[model samples]
Target: MTKQTGGKRWGRKATGESAQVRDGRPRRSRRNTFREDEDLEEQINFSDIKRIGVYLKPYLKQGAVILAAVLSMSAIAVAIPYLTKTMIDTVIPSKDPVKLFTLGGVFLVAIVVYELLLRYRTVAITRVGQLMLKDMRRDLFTHIQTLPFSYFDSRPHGKILIRVVNYVNTLSDTLSSGLINVIADIFTFLLTLIVMFLIDWRLTLWSLVLMPLLVVYVLFLQHFQRRAYQRLSNKQSNLNAYIHESIAGVKTTQTFVREREQFQTFQEQQGQVRKYWMKAVHIQYLMWPGVQNISTITIALIYYLGITGMGGVQVTTGMLIAFVGYANNFWNPIINIGNFYNQLITCSAYLERIFETLDVRPEIEDKPGAVELPPIKGRVDFNDVVFKYEPDGRNILNLVDFHVPAGSTVALVGPTGAGKTTIVNLLSRFYDVSEGSVCVDGYDVRDVTLSSLRRQMGVMLQDTFIFTGNVRENIRYGRLDATDEEIVEAAKAVHAHEFIMELPQGYDTKVEERGSTLSAGQRQLIAFSRVLLADPRILILDEATSSIDTRTEEALQAGLAHLLKGRTSFVIAHRLSTIEHSDQIFYIDHGQIIEHGTHEELLAKKGAYYRLHESQYAMIKTANGEEG
Candidate 1:
């Protein structure tokens, strides 16, 4: 390809081009994709290209149908120009009105058939694309669910959200539209070029001489467009993170009068997005005009050459008309193909971000031979347990040994960041212990299947999470098969039934997102009610009653006394008054259990537990003095 070809292929706005006279030897023609096949040459980003090809598999059938329709339309559409040639050569110069009428009728029928075919083709292909998208989306969601929580903890929530929503949507749209259109354009362009050559090779060669320049223009657009879009994607992720944090902490913002500060930050980011978007649009704006002007000049060349070269032969009006039609049809696809090239480049970053998540291998997964753990005798033991969140973060637990006799209740107490919750997490196997073993009924927790192990231990995390559903539905989330009457019974047992019934729609009232409509204590009650319905043999409650008022706490304490009668339990709470009823108390400090006994025994010993208990007493005394 010549310099003109290179320049046309690489759009004017393309930034990566080396000037023809660079450093030393003439810029060794970069391996032109237009001139070389994959088998004959190498690809710059071969792996990325291959991955893109894999994504196209789901749309292959829809693509085939689209190809057939587009080519059919183009073939017939191109035929009209050729038919005009025939009429000019044989009928128009002869001025046969009968032939004109007959030909006009034929043209009318062709147009009707073409319109109907395209209509059905669009509908059929759209339906197929939608079905494929549905399946892809389902697979993406299911795969994400299986990923370990650590993956999410490492990344910002807004980044994950953008990949899930925007990236997937872009991939789906590209597969459905861009991929189909590009393939059809290639097929039509090639076939039309061949026909034009057969009609008159000299004219065909002269008209497509500008093809090299067209290719250069397209190449330049793809390069800059890629960078522009990638910058825009990063900006979008930042904007998403800001919005997520702002909305999630809306109350905190209002409490501290930081609304204006947040709004200013948001404005700055929004302006950044506009800047990146304009950079991309600027390239696009440069592209169409350049190509249109170049083509318009090419059109003038065609008209000048046609009239001059054919003067002696008395060439008919039909040939001139046909030449004009082909000139118009020829470069439009090049323009379309150029636009698709940019679109393909822009969505590349989106594809990479999305697949990066999908490709992640879970740190821990169920073993091949892992068997379902059957009912156990409710004995638990922690032998030399040691654990931490990260290689560098503070240790949440250290090597130590502890055991609970079958069906006994144990309460864990600690200062903030003392790793009390870490123990619960280990037994639940959310994170495996860094050192030591945790066993239940003689089987190591890690040896058993995750589903079976988790199913057997009921957990109520400190932060109560309730899905957006009706009151009854939220409770039933713990055990999907639970009947409505069973759901009501569980609520009653937990003292949540009375409050639930007072809601406008009773059991059917909708829980707003994050359970926002309900008070914190009310939300806690629903969470416990759900746990009550689950009825696991091993119950581990973390700050379970911290939100309840004195009256509700008394009622719940009474209900829990009856509920904990025969079940094994681990209770962790900050309120010294709450776990005073436990059979044994384990005081945790710096990830190690320092003291263990009944509450009175620990207080009498005047150890770490004694100091913690007295601090709470002092706070109470101060409150009483102020009230007096």
Candidate 2:
């Protein structure tokens, strides 16, 4: 299948190639192996931690409310145990109903206040988390728009989509509540520890005996958990990319009768995801049980010491019960902290992918102090232009120079991959030339802002992209402010109105993405209408009519003449008939212009242009079953 890259098309196969050697050596598929290598090299560094802090910085007010609520809740927790001790030791012994009733009312009020504070904290944390996600997704999407064609060309669309959607979603809970809860858990632990010591230092010290062992286990689990989650993320990304590719080429697969093979490939990719997911989950499951076992052991040991008075300290019934309560409170926070630590490790992997996408600076941004271009007269000049798609790659255009007068049509004819689209792409400044300049009306394209330059140019590609909207809305995409009548007129000018009106709802009929319901000729006509509405001073039609039928092409020729009357047009068409009457024709070959003249002038010389013309005519004759 051929994927559209701005004006150019890149042909790639649906299935991935093997990374194995030709001499029967075994190796992994290139797609899976490449992602694995990338994941293996990833690390969670300090810079990533700092970037996470930046997203959280804006939610300080919300954080403050959540912090206040958590601290208040912790204080109440510590006080409740003391109230129980007071009831057992003093109130009940005095046998005063008033005192007992007063303490009971206080207990009820404390529970109510704690529940209210918990509710407030939940609301505040949720608000901060959702807003942070919104900002991150917005920033990532905006940055993606400014990225150059090369960025999208190099990576699968599914990989990019995962970063913007799934990866950002993975961060929501961790950033919103997980981070603040970790802080709250630490404070809760410290507050409980101080209270436990004040009650009885002997039991407090006994509770801590098993803590070092728990710490050692967590440290051992951390290493394997981090690695497991990282591998799982890589597998998920590979599976996502494969799914996107398969859906896009489902028609081609059906045509080639490869559905069974495609399903097998999907099963293999999904199996990898399942394997890594189980590994990560197994490592996570160990954390809770390990902490729970230690807590149970410590509580039993505290009971034995207090009942037998082994420490030579007097132990009362009320004090023994109160100290046990403090021990549970102290150990519970440690478990919470351990769980938060696991979340931090998992979120770090997602954060790395999100930040990596943001760090890529746009290659085709405006220069410092760039100015908006004034209304152009459409005179274009390519002055000793040199360009290549890659920094170290060979030049696609080498010192190729050309000039076009305002209000003239020039045709570019060349073989496939002969830099025909590169010439037009340079004129639109989709890429900057490695050497020399491409100028419009004596202004260097790079010197003007990209928006201002592109706004004055109309570009229609062979693969016309029709968005999922009504016909009128899609055409109005060319000029957002265009009125309904104006949209109809442009469609009429491009001869698209007749077919559009035939749809169930006329111009208001809804179309699917990429216009699956529309015929190739109909889609091209709508695209042509869109370009006509823009009415750009410089127009580029790259294989604009190649998809349309011969009858439709003939009808469009009249509309094409009207559209090109006062615009400086650059047309690249494979059909020789479309450019036979162009003001000037340049036969491009091997990144160089080998012949240039009008149709008659080039034919008189019997050069490369004449040979191309003769071959095309012969093919036409053969198709009509006529003697050539």
Candidate 3:
């Protein structure tokens, strides 16, 4: 073995005749051991490897102990063949019983010591490998979390998950399996070769004639199996997409009585997997037969040459036994090297995905030297802001400017498709403006850290999202450290305490997945309580009561009014009753504010807001005699 280093990087590349096959074999046809160094060097961006090396610094001492154990264990493994040689060549043949018994005793003792060192080395390597895997996973997860929303929007979650699950796992696998196989195989192979040559060079040379065939077979496995594995990964990701979409819309399927259709769709997808699995299996099937043929050929050569004594040499029985035992050694390493090669190539695409996410620069982040937003006064402003969802989509907001004064309530009313929601999205910094800027309390929203800016605002959307947890934990999600008393108080303030207390375990009851156990009205009350616990100085109520029954809406309206007082509030309302009492109203259409005034002023003008409010559809009632 030799090390090749340049730019302080390590690679093992055998050169010239060392890479050649044995005599009497066509060496030029055999595959070379080393990869194309320049190709790998250019492709594998191991920039963070230096960081990984730093992590290994603390483990060097333990690593040294493990290395010593590995070397000693290897020496003991090599000792077994030599001891048999000694018994056959000397003690037993000399008819010296005492010498035979002493050799037997020493062999027993060596086996005991070897087992201890082997166990210790296994534990040490595993412990170090696990620690490194843990640190690597943490860093990868953190990097992924910081990536921009657009990154996730463009990429599938299953593809990203494959990176987190399978790709990162490969970081340690190189050390655990690929590396261990190479070292153990080379050491055992080398020691056996030296011993076989010493016993009879002619026989050793003949035995090695089959190596070229073995090397050729392994290279084919590496190439074909690698391609198969990639297809397998792609097929698996497709299956994940189907499963995610199916589960997400299970209700729609059931409502339409489409269970059979859904099952048929899944079966079609599973059928694809079966086809790919067969291709992968067939490629794998070809490898073992190739290997078995090489082994069989080597044994045939041995018998033919040995029986004829054509080389003018008498190969002893012990030598033949040792050579047969040595031949079995090739089986496992040959298979493992092929398997590792397959895994390595499959993970390459996954690693690219993970690294791409990690390398993304967030669209919004705290600027250099950004300072804390101290004691906000609840003032909000958007100046000459122009924005659109896509570059080709109609401008969601044109050159619009708006302001909400401290200690005031402002309502934004418009027909459907008006940019009412966009206004609130800008205020929350869910997105930044395409032109101009939004400022909160004299600080640019982008200049302030996201966490700092978000801490000062409370948002209640039309679609209330509740995670799977008990009522207490869900309310406390707003402020994780809130005391139980504070959580209960917030719930009571929102009129949610009555409904929560009636559940199976009061605040401790587990809300089913996505809070399916709760009604839309019940969930919204809990969501409002969640916002109340955060105690933001600026609040957004964007159709906050849209999904509730009239009675529940009425019960919470007073508390909502109280919550709105003394805070810069922006309310996006479709229902005229919700926003009629605001200090100011902005009637937005086609991404522009066509009118702005008090509700009475807008009503007097008989503009867009007035038209929407006057429509009979706005007050349609159901058979239950409730407002639509």
Candidate 4:
């Protein structure tokens, strides 16, 4: 292939670019995108609040204790202000030293008790919130696993990660500190207002006159606050996505010497994040100053009324002082609540994001009465199967029909985008067929529990993934109950034992993430061992040996031939060796099998498979001559 043709083929295959159109029009993506015009308003929903409340239900008994503690703290706060009023009016005015001392002692005792209650409430509330957070994280992760592959394919990995991490962490404050603080502030505000009215109704009215104006201003600030926070959340998610992509593809970036370009891109994303954060800060600054100014004006008005003895009421010094105290208490809670209102507004979007993930129903789930499939006999059949990743997108597999007899090895040969992988995906039931049925052992794969069906099938893909663990542990992942001896035996069978034993720690040698420390050939060998340990009745290898060295390929073919015996296996044919030995060969193109026969039979026909074999052989010979 020419360089341009090869690049185009790889690009279209990797990104599903070839399937991006239907009927000569571009296919619309199903992915959701964040847009500024999309519902920037934050409206409180009772159902969402109620759903969060359910998380607290399991800790209801403990929540009550926390509630009681919070209530007591508020009550004690109210009592302290009254005690000061009494000490100033009754205890001090008459010069009664004994009463003064006694009141002073009582005040000291109240302070100590208040501190104790505050400590209890803080610890109890925090602990409960933490427990609730734990449960929410667990549920979110478990729910993510149940979602269909298409759900993940539609969104960036970083966006999903942000929901699982930053967004969930944001809930911790609301669950623990935010909930209790809001309740406490509300109660304090009401109690202080009552006491103010009792002290002198005239001054009380003066202090509250500007209250509605403050509320209106706060609401105005909150609108901007919510919008600013929404922007910040969007930018933060974008930044996370960029960072994850950059790290994963750093090798490519370095090879192309695009570090400077990537760094500039990083700076641009960071700049966006900073801009949104500053906008939120500016909005908050406007709100807090406005609230404080209104509060100060109210205090000034109360003092003016007290000094003048307004409304024909005598305002004693003690009463005036006590009223001022109540006035401060009254405004303090409003300010606190106003701040918290902004917090809730910001968190509202994050909450919605989290709930959106939880609300997704898996596209392919077990039927209500789906039975657990017994051991599969490996007979696979596809009858007029049609499939599309998106409902409105081009059909990936159109009216495809094929059958693999029990205990047979089938090699699928196709150019890129010929629906080779889609066949295996259907047989495994990763997705349900859009039309007709995929049957394994005479049972529709969709009619069986997903776990029961998948557990009995093993897939070794072109890109082998070795998780972060020891060699032994990675192999044991196929069958968690496998003994160490069995693991080593499987490794030896795949010719992986010699290299593994030479590693720094032998079987216990640490594997880096994605097995980056290992070569391509070594990773494929480890993958082979993983599959062998599973010993499934049906095995699918999609270009599994594509990365192995010529020498290693020779060693693996012996073990693979033995392993393929009496098991239904589908291999996406690339190598001549793999195709030649198959019980049957299928030459597929454009979602149709153009030819099917043994190696000798296909050569005699001199059709599509013949051309493909000739080209591949010529390329190999040219490569060998160049090496020489």
Candidate of highest lDDT: 2
The TM-score obtained by model 2 is: 0.92
C-alpha displacement of 39 in model 2, angstroms?
A: 3.6
TM-score of 4: 0.92
Stretches > 4 Å off in candidate 2: 1-37, 312-314, 626-628
State the lDDT at 86 in candidate 1: 81
TM-score, prediction 3: 0.82
How well does model 1 score by local distance difference test?
0.75
Stretch of 10 with least lDDT, candidate 3 = 33-42
Clash total of candidate 3:
0
Stretches of model 1 off by over 4 angstroms after superposition: 1-62, 171-173, 310-317, 392-394
TM, every model: 0.87, 0.92, 0.82, 0.92
Query: 1 or 3, which is superior by TM-score?
Result: 1
| Per-residue alpha-carbon lDDT of candidate 1 for residues 546-618, written as tens digits (9 for 90 to 100) | 8888789889888778778777899999888888989889998877788999989999999999999999999
lDDT of 3 by residue, 276-343 (tens): 87887788777667767776777677777766777865766555555555555434445555555545
How would you encode candidate 4's per-residue C-alpha lDDT over 218-242 as one tens digit per residue? 7777777777877787888878878
Question: What are the clashing pairs of model 4?
Answer: none
In candidate 2 the C-alpha lDDT for residue 357 amounts to 73
lDDT ranking from best candidate downward: 2, 4, 1, 3
- Give model 2's clash tally: 0
